[model samples]
Target: MLAMALSTAPAHAEDGYELWLRYHPLATEQASLYRSRASQLIAGSATPTQTVTRKELLSGLNGLLGREPTSSDTVTSDGAILVGTPSSSPLIASLRLDTKDLGKEGYLIRSVTVDGHTATAIVGNEDVGALYGAFHFLRLVQTERSIDRLDVRESPHIKLRVLNHWDNLNGEVERGYAGASIWDWWKLPDWRDPRYTDYARANASIGINGTVLNNVNAGAEILTPRYLEKVKALAEVFRPYGIRVYISVRFSAPMEIGGLKTADPLDPNVQHWWRSKADEIYKIIPDFGGFLVKANSEGQPGPQDYGRTHADGANMLADALAPHGGVVMWRTFVYSQTNADDRAKQAYTEFKPLDGHFRDNVLLQVKNGPVDFQPREPYGPLFGAMPKTPLMMEFQITKEYLGFATHLVYLGPLYEEVLSSDTMAHGQGSTVAKVIDGSLGHHTLSGIAGVANIGANRNWSGSDFNQANWYVFGRLAWNPTLASRTIAEQWVRMTFTNNEAFVKPVVEMMMGSREAAVDYMTPLGLHHIMGPGHHYGPAPWDASEARADWRPVYYHRADRNGIGFDRTRAGSDAVDQYAPPIAAQFNDVKQTPEQLLLWFHHVPWDYRMRSGHTLWYELVAHYTQGVDDVKHMQETWRGMDGYIDAERYQQVAAYLAIQEKEAQWWRDACIAYFQSVSGLPLPSGFAPPQHDLKYYESLTFKNVPGYSSW
Candidate 1:
């Protein structure tokens, strides 16, 4: 009867809807081992966080152990899992674990003795800490780690690890590839979706504590009373998971949403309007995180429109949120056509001067690179230059420039590269990681944000490998020092089979995937040459756009004399933004790393590369190398059919085929264009493109998905 009942319970095939929380029944040996340790639950707390902790533990335990565990106030039997702070449970109090320095969100899971009973205690200083501990405990079993004699203490290094969703009010997502917006704004205040709770669970499992629900290119109507009620509903669903809600505030909300005449940051009426708005938000959602502002960039109205500075605009909102303990994530992605000297140097030029001017509650959210999220970019110079202000790193988990979701490019290596790059602000050892983690500058407040790639898709990130990007971002945000390779390995083991045969090769493929994308799409630091408007395929010869910087011809100045942007003192002098030693290296063509050679210098077509080939030959070789890598990735995935679910396996297989074709398109079109400019023959023994230059240029994406944001 018991076996029959178990079989009758509702279950679905693994279509990746469960994400990494797929607590499927483990291998017989592992399941029995975990069952021996987690036979009963002894959760003695009833608070909201504790309730979720109890619920999660029971669900995970039932799925993995193949049977539900009995909940008990006291552990009368052995193999009991005790989860709660000392104050909430007598069993946890008797163990007397030292949780003093664990902080409010940190926890320690240990094997301890209580009342002559041997048990595993997930103890913390608070209930939310215990909740985090619960997720970790399940992860141990899911990853098939030994639970015997466990003694682990964990805490988040960064204070505000968050996700910035570019989802809009009307079910559209800017640069979002997965699907339509998940937030059903029309039915949200009344019809709360169960998916919202699942989203919160996924974020909390990975230590992501906050989310901005709207796009940074914000709509002011989102600030009105109607939308506030919808935001409050989502916040209620997320509150127990320790995730707070934030909004992307349009800088001119006072004028657009309010009845103010002039939306100047210094204007008395504008300041008063913002303070009242803050109070209104706090009344509905008491723990609302704060505002994320993008001002005076890309036609967005800002303080610069009112003859004030970026600091003035940010400080105005910062003052309003101060009384409520909210903050301002002032974006530094500012650029204008008037100052179109170097797109790579614009953010640093603007924000570096106002280093110490921001209020204590405001954080300057700088992108991982100086320019937009290219396939590969040097660390943003503003990271180390601003010491007095808290500089939060903003990474894009979405694949905007790197083939969107169709390409299997893992972003772990990309994140690791920017974080590990040394800034030399406090001498030789100051990595960008230290600067953002508040260790190098000794600033109390610190954070890291990712432009979330999540949407309404069932798989959540469009593809299985793409989920690794989202997972890695949250993991890195919690602790920037963690290795990307390590995170990739863990994600693979949990998301797929733990079998070593599957884990090793998949990790190897992921570790090199980003570099592969870079070699083909934007090798040697060639940036922003994708198709205009839709950014789908190659368009290197495109120069017809009105704005000079918006066109591909402006970035890669390929001519008969040379084929690169010169950022040396004679050119745009963008290399001068870096620290003196770094700038000196970048200014010298011979000293610049070959990966970034084209980014910093305008070299001759006949210039030699370290690979013993002319620049023309080396460039062609990189494009072909990228195409070859995609072929290799496809071959690797074809052999791992039994490791993961058939649905995800086929989805990844189909996407890899798409990537291979697109990679070839990039290689051929870019080569054809550069050859036309340099007037150079193809490298000896190298075949010409599949089509002529005009043929490649004639191909267009008339209706690309996820393009028309407006």
Candidate 2:
């Protein structure tokens, strides 16, 4: 019987290979409406970009309208959709659209007339822009939006919108949960997978203009000629889609791959080696999007290794790529485990002094938070501090800290929180969004990256709902000011059923997901208390790591006296890094926002909360609220049975069950550990842990995957 069970085949299911481009046949009424509006596609030229644009329109029209639209070079019908750049199509040129205002990657879609026939024209200054416009048109029909009076002008606000793949050379993704690396390095330069084109299509549809192919714990061999050939092949495939390829280079690559004695940024020989290497790379790939370096942090060699600063290291590389029209994204996620300093204060302490020292093309790629990607963290202090330099915001799309791929935590709210935060650099209204988008201090270069959650999984991201994070990342990357709830609605409409009955509840659940995780996992700015290496389940009792800061106890400092790390002037003085008003608020326990009260103050269990409950009671209430939220989500998902496919619906339902169990585990384990420390009883109505603290502590996971921290 056991042998028979092992031999059983998996059930047939709807694999998530299609992503959000699911142009399934629309409802009957909507299909008729779309068919009339999208009658024929007039693709004027046969450029690679235009060809894909036409093909995509045909595919989308055929799938959504239930009948393929006629393809032609001329306006053969009244509802012809003409698409091209002005230089490529005479009809677009005759329209005399103000394309001068639309940059290379911007497009204008208007309901216009050509050849005595009423038609919709999608015109751009370049072919890639038209391709983006084509995707936009398909999305409208797919989302069942009316395109009758279309006159939309669109462009990405930030100069660089990129996805940083934490993939390694060995087909292993550092923090990937979906599956193995998608790059398939061994098969790459020879076999161009059809998946690559689809990946490009997915990115281009949402205005992602760049991708880093390797992990920041970069291997030196990726800079070798052998891998450069492979990279060139990918460059060719992604060029038409307007995505430039960037590589995360090992800082000591000159020595690791070039047989140099030293990689000192100030060394003349090392500089020459990098300059020659840049020229060599440009000769093979002219449109290469420069290098991303992880140096002096996490044991990666940098200018600091040679007694030089970060500016020296970044400026050295910036000079090498300057002649090639490239830029260096020097990461600002620096900290030292060897030092007993506050982790929250390290990045700002290092980079704040060197603001005006970096070269013209160098951007300090700062993480969204001062510390690592916590469930809830204050916006990084560096956003408004560096007035003379460009700062790119980095967000982690992969849920390393939040229960990996299984938990349904949407990060849109987390991202929106950080982006909308007021850095207060120049008094009122100086938001982090304005700082990174080059509007705060009026700097030219700006970029934002989501450490990609993508992998070889059929669904792109591991689970069905996880794809919303990827979708929202792209949308928010295009325009930082977009409301996350609005993006959620757009995704729900496109990916799942557009029923009003389904969309509202689903969007509400998604909007609250991040906060729910915070309440259950690490509420009120408490962070990094998960399992030591794997970061799987709750481990508030962990303090056994070699480095003190890596342990959960070091972060929470939960004892009989109180709980929470004190970052005010009386403690680590980390609050001093923020602007004066913000600093003062964090310094005072009463003035500090309750959501971040514990982050700045270590209060006793008897301390009063804004809710009129003692700190201990409120904490228990929050943890209980988190578990209850999961139950509500389970009920909500159960009611959404008929809205989506049976396979995806059942998959989400099973995951919700897993999440409920995990949320309970988090609540129980954390509460039991805290109760042990505070010597306090559970609040009157709150339930006690299902098991003792020892039972939760004994639950060790030796093989939980996606634990890559670097």
Candidate 3:
């Protein structure tokens, strides 16, 4: 039986404004069972967090069970839920559950008998943890899990699970497809949007404890007193939900805001200015998380401006924030046009030599791939390479390269693939997950940041499915070992419908969505071929850009004889950056995974693939398969009309239609360009490109959304 049966809600449609917290009424049988188990709530409301926790439980229960459970101080009823910390509730303290081992943010939910009345106890070491537990309890009811013998204990493996917003001060979000920035900077510091509270609730429910508010390509004005007050107002709203706000800092802020001549890291005046700024910020927002710096990359100012190392820049800010318990997240997405070597190897080349030079509070925030957020790429070499330094994974939740918000690309599988990858730093079993969780390096601080796709859209993420990317990112940050399929199943049940027939196929579709995108877009490790600036559609022939690395032709490097970048010993030698075992495997063309064949080696067009087909034939097959997969997705969603509200269902249906048309556009364009380069005919039984090479090359996009004006 479906947990949340077909909605008893009025025929009025849903606009997906409620995300996964939709606590629609459950089926008769499920509701009766859950209502009996939740007859009374005995959670305390002494603190602001406790008050919100109580409010959430009441709201969720009222919606899910069709009525609010009686709120009480003591568990006199048979099926009461007693939730609190030892200090907050005497009822919880009397139970004497083993909460000593549970960390400050960890919680234990167990069934206990108090005064001969059977009750569920949600115990934590802190109020925020109890709030988390309350959310988990609501999830159980939402997902129709049995609460009869509940003994669920949960804690975040990563210390700083944060969302990195690319929102700018001008209210424009770089690479944000949903809408304008959600901050409403003009109205903030005076008017706190109720949406901010909902944002905190959604993040807290998934165990994300921190958020970087501004773009890493930051502006100096954000550091001024006026903006600091605005940030303080937003912090107050998020504090109750346990979310500490962080900001991306302009590296030359001392020069721009403090009226300093030079913002050198080693300069005494510069150091004093940063210290004073930190003190000022802490006074306004005491629990403020530290700076996220994109210095020395993409024209951002940094220590490099003063001929100092990345460590010099990061440590300078780390010192100022150390007294206030803040840490600096220094981005490792550094590349320069001066360096002629592979763009993929630049981050490792630059940061590897500076290992252990950083302060203990500084985390080297590395992207999942050595390159930018490509549709698919190998795990970054820095994961294991920087064992002496604390490294946090930075994933792009925005689908900038994967058809923006229109394409149904579930990033859960992509995140899981990167986290579960074995870095092999300490022989075997040293996964990327271990590296970031402080287990591999035995370091204390750990974190993972997702470049948030959230905007002012009613759905939060641009589309209903895009919300799953945000949802899964938080879930995996809490526990990296979780299966993407499991997360997808949970999201499908909560977001749309719990009907088995509707859920099973939708989960399957989501699981394969990323791979389908990879096949259609950048198959066989061909990365960064999207249109320049906006990164909308395929632009395999786009080479007019002034910089060699920024052009599409720079990456694909297609020629009349063959295709693919040569990163072997004879070429860029980028494979040597990985561990010796991984290097050896990638060095051998036959040994490298076919999915990443083009990433490491330049193979001839007629070379035989593992499938015994020629390289050209395999490419055509994969592209064809991708289009077929999107068609299958369309077919799958077509049957889900009545499963969810017509408004959301029809919107999803329309987006899928758009995705199919664009997938075909990607297929036809790429095939035309590659065929023109390789001088190869389309494989037998395959359809030729709809247009000639010139047509695909002539395509131009204007006024495209999410362009990085900065």
Candidate 4:
């Protein structure tokens, strides 16, 4: 429906401070059509949430329709937009819309005749649901959807849709491509930045109900009284928008902050300290969303330090928060340098045995893949393995491995790939989406978290195109099964122009962008070959890290014979972690998906591929194709110079230029390293690397943005 083109004139320069909530005036025809249906607004201010819902509706309608809707207690005119729950508004209660099935956060929007006047009712079971409904209604208008004969009933499939901010207390965000942390701890508890409210609004607009406000590699200082007051201030600002604030807590906080002798979960003293801390936090921020723990992984302290299991650690925190109606989101990203097992199988091995060991309030937050957020990976084995435990899907919205902020790698496709993966735990149709949505496991508690790309940058994310990653993550977190292509199209319409010509190519670009990244960066199941520490660019030969797992060479394992990790039964037996069907597929080199052939098996350089080409030849082809795709993306973007605002269009064009250059760098560096290792001649008609292997290896970055040290 979004099919209007811009007039042939110099459009205004729009710095992307507005994000997807950019309620810019619609095209003249679309505005007129929408205005007719949203002539008047009837919403209550019975609570803080209802008040903000009314404010947002008026603001969005005014911006989109070129006029504010008339505020009325009753439907005085045809095409009035009515919003609220039964308890909040008398008009909504009189409609007698069956909201019993809608639950606390679900909403129903329908066209109904009230007092002989035609009106659109956005009713929900709760005020927060109505707020969600209001945002949905605005989305329909922004995307140019018809409001007439509306009968949309929507609810979040997952219970807790959250954003995990890897932000530190001192204004730094680990793996954060955007600027510094937006929490503004220095000014908080006094000077509340307007950006905080905007942040909450943007999150609530997309149905993200909670946010963990600090880095998962947390510091003990966050639990201190000073920081609690600051966190309390943020909770207040976000509360009106129905977003609860969560904190990532250090497992050793009982000793580091509480002045206890031991932080053991089994100790009565340690339990009492945590219980008191929970009480203190709840008293400060009553609706606080509870703790996100990253214990015994990557040098972070946890219950393992005290000889307790992951469940023991998580349940302890869960018990502390249970009386307050809070939850514990325990991260399952555990891998030990001491253990000589495959890194990908460690999380599953540790948690699979403790399926029902965790308390009801505890959610095992698992990354979408077994490995860290590589451009591509098989869905995490833990998704289906631990049926009794509530597994929370954690996706990284920030392009940490996909060229940080510069590359226009929309992650919707990647998310779709992982979510739609057939885990085959229960049967053929069992998907990771089903596992996390609680449909497969039948768990009452469920969650999905996106590691946030948000920051203090005006555009929120580092680049203009990068904002699409954040938008897509939030939309998909609400309902994981929704097509990524559909979400991309909706985002394109809402963020930029709705013109058919502009929308078609741009959506295609976004949908294919992730695959393009996977192709160039880690084609054919190549994983974690990025530079050590910063992970900025290709470093396949980087064997300099102190730990073997931290080295790029450790992951690729390229020798004179082959270039791949052998994760089959002959190797680490990592394939056995998946369900039987998946394990069988991954174990046999012939049966495995070509994309994941290298991930599961180490093949000879001359091994035959499904394409009838040698493995080495296919690798070279995939790398070359990735570069070509980026070039194609540049060409497609160049054609739309006049379709949107010059500022955004030009910036995107510049970023694509950067992406093309970097894609070439990845292609060249990787090919050079692999060629050196495999001793293979380039297939006919294929170009050699831009420089020699030595030249690629000599390159070093002193200051990459997203590096945790920076």
Candidate 2 lDDT trough over 10 residues, lowest sum: 1-10
The ten-residue window of minimal lDDT in model 4 covers 1-10
Indicate the TM-score of model 1.
0.97
* Stretches of model 1 off by over 4 angstroms after superposition: 1-12
- In candidate 3, where is summed lDDT lowest over 10 consecutive residues? 1-10
TM-score of each: 0.97, 0.97, 0.98, 0.98
lDDT of each: 0.89, 0.88, 0.92, 0.90
What is candidate 2's local distance difference test score?
A: 0.88
Per-residue C-alpha lDDT of model 4 across residues 1-710, encoded as one tens digit per residue: 01011111124668887778878889899899898899999988878998889888888888888888999888888989999888877788888999999988999999999999999999989999999999999999999999999999999999999999999889999999989999889888998887888888889989999999999989999999999999999999899888999999999998897888888999999999999999999998889999999999989999999889998999999999999999999999999999888888899899999999999999999999998999899999999798888899999999889998889999998999999999999999999999999999999999999999988888899887888888888888888889989999989998897899999999999888888998999999999999999989999898898888888888889899987899999999999898898999999999999898888889899999988999999999999999999999999998898998888889899899999999999999999889888887888989999899889889888878867651
Q: What is the C-alpha local distance difference test score of candidate 3?
A: 0.92
Task: Show pairs that collide, candidate 3.
Answer: none
Please provide, for model 1 over 292-351, each residue's C-alpha lDDT reduced to its tens digit, 9 standing for 90 to 100: 999998888899998999999999999999999999999999999898568888898889
Ranking by TM-score: 3, 4, 1, 2
Supply the TM-score for candidate 2.
0.97
Q: Candidate 3, TM-score vs. the true structure?
A: 0.98
| Clashes (candidate 2) | 0
Residue ranges of candidate 3 with Cα displaced over 4 Å: 1-11
